[model samples]
Target: MDAVPGRKAPMASGSAPDLMYCQPCAEDGNKILPDAFCPVCKEFLCSTCARVHRNQKITKSHALQDKTSMPSSFCAESEDEKFSVTCQHHSKEFIKYYCPRHDALLCGDCVIENENHRSCMVEKILQVAKRYQEGEEYISLKTGLGQMVRDIENYILYIQVRMKSVDEENLTNINEFRKFRNEINQYLDKRENELLAEIDQTKRTSKTFLNELKTKYTNIKSATEKLQSDLHAHEANSNQLLIVGKRAIKELEDLQTALEKVSMSKDVSRYTFDRDPATERLLASETAIGRLKEGESTTTLGQQQQKQEKKQQEQRKQQESKQQQHKPTQAPSHKVNFQSSVDLSQSQFSRQPDIPMKTSGDTRNCFLSSVACLSGNRILLADYNNQSVKLILRPTWCCPRLLCQVDHGTCVNCPVTGQPSL
Candidate 1:
């Protein structure tokens, strides 16, 4: 039987009018009592319509329940009183099917509207939901998420540790730099003070020496004035005049000698401050200060005096040697008695006799440059004329035997230079 428009459908005898009717049959204008409810379609179905729904390939997989056992809300008369959940795309349809290919739930309208599902495998959304709860893909996804979280946490920890270490290293470097700077500052300060002290001392010493010279020159001037006054006063007396004249001449000579002895050599007293060359180069790229050194053009006065004395001694020796070479040689007249021990302080002789030794080779024209006494009563003589050094063993003063002779060139005439002890 077909349903009439705007008319109440006649129910079976003794059946309630509020009982749900088959939705498919009602669309065809037939009023049929419902035997089953299709959850997928969200509609009541008659026994005949339910058999047709199951026979179709598209609706065969949809789940259905007995109408009498269906929920009262699902079988409500008003469309708004049906299931609460609805499809996102089709607002009026409920979500029933799941498309595995799209990984989304779909309504009956969506399945028909989208052509992508024509060849895609789709199942009930409830069945897909149940399988996902126990599937390996879901479990693996959760596991992978957990692993990512752990990895991120480890990276964070590593970064924190590295940052802490870097901070500590930076602080350590800063402290070291501070200490190094302080040390350099202190050293420079101390060196500056020392250099200043040296300069002050040099100035004071120079001034003191100048003052002494000044005082000595002033005394000399006063004495010269006195002599001039005496010469003028004694001009009338011949005896006093001769005496004053002689005294003035002597004073003038003494003044001349003093002036001759005084030397003003600027090369001997020049001073300067300089930085160490190596330290100066090092300062080009570093923070450290270069060291300062006080330099002088010449040695100290005492050192200069020592050197002068040594040169004078050498000159005196050369002069004595020349004098000895000019003297005539004579044979010994007496044989001296040899003593086991002699007191040097009491030892005295008017004339010491030279012991003559016989030599094998010609010695008359031989110019001996140097002589040295060796161990075991040996003597080394360097003969400049023959250009040879002769080593002699003198067992007795009268009988000196030549042990060996070495020939050399200009070295024979040069001063004997000392060598390291063997």
Candidate 2:
């Protein structure tokens, strides 16, 4: 039987026609195991062949498991699966190594039973908390950046709307100016036509009056010549002179009337067409029209004013910008300062031995010390053994950096485990 179920026999290709058999057990007539196992030598085999080794009688004393059964669970690698744990320091999956002092995750159970951590100050180790101040600073910076972006966006939108309104107003003013120009042109044309009509009428009336005066003057001259000829023929009679005198008087009266009409019709120097006040007004108006026709004298006073004002405005703007630039932008700057000395000669406890915290790098660690914030944002930490004043920075709570490890022996005024003088 095959080790696993549902196995098939292996086939071999050859030239023989009638009897095509497997190459492993070729026509030997050994008991053919079915498809899965090796068929050669017939020790429960299949069509394909595999090597089979037989041990001699001397080495057969070795104990071996039966091929029909699986491996034992006790000897299996999975037997220790229940003891698997994770390492805290290395952050890896490991077995137990216990910490006796902290009583936390441990790979070795014997570690918790040992006294290696007897001197460790449990109270001081437990005092360390999570950092919240740094988180607050990050949030504040994010809020400030958001507000600045919003303010800039609002200013840009305001400027666009204002510029659009100004453009609309300029268009309206241009339309009004065009309408006013058209009305003035219409008034000028009407006035010019009226003046021309009055001049034409005056010329017609004067010409008619001149023609009538010339005819009357010619008739009087002809009558005077006829009387002279008659007087010469009748010089012996004196009564003819009286009739001639009366006729001359009548002709003189007609001549005086005709002359008065001619004098009234003639244009005086004071009131000639060119010099007339009304015509002068018309000429002045025409000159005004010509000026108007030449196109409007559009003076951009606003532009001129803006150009003039720009200098001072720009100066003022620059001043304001400079002031803004120079103005101190204040942000919260965290400063951590350590005091001069430390004293640690006190604290008698019953159960645990005093463990002085050991620092490897540029940090100073202390155990079982009372640190407090004082006036003027200074910190005072009581170091009992060191017999000196120790200062710690507030806010950042950085480890007490050694500024001056002053010995109380040298400074006579300094007292042990007391506040330092400012």
Candidate 3:
């Protein structure tokens, strides 16, 4: 009788032949039950298959829940299943009671039984709870706004810091260039000093060689002239012939042979003085000196390496320059035109202004103000200083401009009851 109206026979627990079975182990897949279920489909699985699924690192969060049943959507600390209660005074909880003074929670039983909250006004407690809820929302918005403000402030500071750093870096680069120029100048000075010293040494060597050659030439010329004069005197002597009778004739022959030998000696001395070997060496040295004056023009290893390094640095700098240009775009400009909406029965607008100013040749500044839309489609200008509120436009106009001027002695939240009052 407990069966489905006795219409059919109940299947045995272990006799369902059509149930899915594990292909590898040949066990009932649904009821034989794996150690855990798949996180993706929540399907039961054996330990061996679980190991296989665990290898997928990204799918690791899909692990089975501890108890195997689905988890609840309700708050973890709440036991209530109905009336979706939340802490009105604590700003947090979906079904929990909190005491604002003690900053704690109480279950439903505790609220009825606990004596700690006996004298507390329940309505006031509820009001505090409501305020807490509103405060929570307000704090959330404030947090978001604060984060945005901080981000914008940090962005502005980053831009300034980066711009200053760039300026300082450029100044440093200029100084480095000046230092490089000084270094080049000093190198040239040292090079010139060494070259001048080499040239001076070469000049002294050339001058000494030339002077020695000149002195040898002068001596040779003087010796040749004296030898010629003595030979001429011997040829013209008359007493010399008187002494040369039969016995003097042989003496005269010997004297003539001795004078020929002396003339040969003078010729050899002249040849030795005229053909100075040191003079030829000095000429070769002068040729080497001229070659030294014209320095070798071939590139050294250091210069070639420096050129290559500069090319690579330029490529890297170009990539960095491209990255620097990748930034978010500016906001779109909205122009208010009043003539387009002539048929609409009701017109609504909030006054807000975003102004842009060119900071420099390559930069700009933008300032933005808040906007609020109130009742009556009438624009209200909220001036933080002047206690007066100005009606910006008539109801006939669709989009009107709102202007607010601040005076020293005025409150922004002054009543909006009569004329000149917001």
Top-lDDT candidate index: 1
TM-score of each: 0.41, 0.28, 0.26
Quote the positional error of residue 341 for candidate 1 in Å.
Answer: 75
Tell me the whole-model lDDT of each prediction, alpha carbons only: 0.65, 0.46, 0.47
Identify the runs in model 1 with alpha carbons over 4 angstroms from their true place: 1-129, 263-268, 275-422
Predicted structure 2: lDDT: 0.46
Angstrom error at residue 212, model 1: 3.2
- TM-score: which is higher, 1 or 3? 1
Clashes of each: 3, 25, 5
Runs in model 2 lying further than 4 Å from the true structure: 1-138, 208-212, 225-422
Candidate 3, residues 109-163: lDDT per residue as tens digits?
A: 4556668765543332332453564466668988999999987887777678767
On lDDT, the stronger of 2 and 3 is: 3
Model 1: pairs clashing at backbone N, Cα or C within 3 Å: 2-29, 2-30, 3-29
